[model samples]
Target chain A: MPATRYRAAPAATLSIVSLDLMRAVYHRASGRTHLVSEPVPEILAALADEPLDEVALLDRLARDYAIEGDAAALGERLEELVATGLVEQL
Target chain B: MNHVFAVRIGPVGFRVGSDWRAPIDTLADLYRDYPAPEDGIPDFSVRLFARRPWRRVLRPQVMIGGDYTIPDAAPLPLSLGLLAAEMGMNLQMALAQRRYLLLHASCIERDGRAILMTGESGAGKSTLAALMMARGWRLMGDEFALVEPETGLIYSFPRLVSLKNQSVGVVGEALRGARFGPWQRDTPKGDIRHLVPDGASIAAMAEPARAAAILFPAYGHAPDRREVAPGECFVRLTQASTNYVALGERGFDTLTRLVRDVPATAIDYPDAATACAMVEEFAA
Candidate 1:
């Protein structure tokens, strides 16, 4: 069995503006502006480069950033991004 | 289309046509201080007409139609024809205007800068703006704050301030000797009256000012003030705008700049006086 993988929309498709506590992302594909906090933006940035399954995504996050939550939390955040059409599931 | 009245507010011009003369007469009186549309041509045309010929004579109802319309909008009694005309103009701007970002907020300018107040209905922003105008702040607008997406400057709309219920009396009393439109009682919003913006606002309608700060005000609450974070301001403003989604990237870029550059605060007040005092302190 193969694990599921996810990738973010291309950087050009999103116009991300950083406000102090959150980021306002304008998704050109959906024409929706979403306000996302810390881990959500971090996850999207990580997924920008390539599609990664849960374990690899978590490993990269843990190595590269100060992630506050566990694998379950990361999974939940990824689901939210996918729901908003900011991330693609494969 | 027997009667026509045209007036320019800030950067937009509206020509209102009606089957009956009364509403156009009322609009002409209320907007007398305003100039005619640029070069005598209006940017938008609003029509107040009867659904049928007999509807114009018996139980007359004013149906709002214009460059854009809600097709299913219920007609207003001829008594509320003025409101219908105003609604028609607002509908055109809210739906069709793309030259500027339309914010459902009240604004006032002073010393070359403006303060924008936006919140849910009954937030007392209109009353606050009217009161602030009486106290010498230039009334930019009550219904909508038009922001130029390119320059980020706020233009003056300076239309008649719609005063409802108790606010009608509060502002009427404060603005003694000021021109007022006829009062219509028991309407949808309740006891509605229109207050003409002061002469200075109309005279300076063409001038634009930079936005100084943003305020989310709530009436009938214990006096409290808090600083709003930029992220919260950004979210609130997106909801406050009528054409943000339609403006696409331009809207996002302009709004982000506004939220980042301007400070935002939320003020809850027990009464108009307290709200005015808090605003004065902040503006100073």
Candidate 2:
């Protein structure tokens, strides 16, 4: 499987922490240690050592997650995650 | 007139009172909708009295009140809404007592095993629970579930799945015979409240079953995608738990006891129907 791309979005700090609370425990038990949440295992794998911007994040995920066929679909997913405090706008 | 009512969230007793009567009715209605355990008489207790200056206190055991007067023994003075919020917090505390812990999430059960789903308010937790219930998963509890500490058994509470704002229609479409109460306006959480079909054994829902898996559900802008990871699921579950602070020495034991024995996953989907299908299929 290819890497998953994660987008960091603007949201309340509490929302971010709440997601972190879930992501942190999930990562800890899996032994996937990191300074923060949002770069899920799949996301981490895709962009290893290479930082990608917002569009790149979506483009990479569209290809890797098999979420193809519509560029609009990619934009929507990025925006949705941004709303959910999962991804950020650059 | 001050309206005071007592209801139990899992093992804790929460009494909420305010100058207004609607909150009491709202809470009482919430409890009445889901019958209590015939065996356990809600040993964990707390009393919230509403006065001009509402106060809340959490003693070693319970929060007692004497009308508007704050007794010297009262631990904290709280707002009326704070008393209401205690319902969730008390549930969290009670779950920490046993091997089971409360997650800041929602859960639905099928075949006696729980599929835990969690997310922030708008992340679609309630919507997912409602959809799964429509498709055949037993309504374990909405927004909160009580799991057995030692056995990872999820005790069913059969409570209403609270949907907020726009998600109400999303769930209604999925559930054919959904029932909803009148919408209350201008509350802290905004316009909300709806009731899914009452589970067949709601009155008998205290029966506990092992928690088979935990799924962190996320609704994507797209509608058909599904991702499943049993290993990562377990890891996320331990993180969603609310009692990690209270479980202490027993935290590791309790968490490992549950996660190591069961599976966990992260569920990302586009719509309620697809989400429900994925949950039911996985539980099956």
Question: iRMSD per model?
Answer: 0.6, 10.1
* Chain B TM-score for the candidates in order: 0.98, 0.72
Number of clashing pairs per prediction, in order: 0, 22
DockQ of each: 0.85, 0.02
Candidate 1 residue A5 C-alpha distance from true site, Å: 2.3
Highest lDDT: which candidate?
1
Q: Highest TM-score: which candidate? A: 1
- lDDT per residue for candidate 2 within B22-140, as digits (tens), equals 44565565457554433545444334433334322221222334222224533322322333334433443445344456666777776677777776667787777777777776677
Task: For model 1 chain A, give the 10-residue run with minimal summed lDDT.
Answer: A62-71
Q: What's the chain B TM-score of candidate 2?
A: 0.72
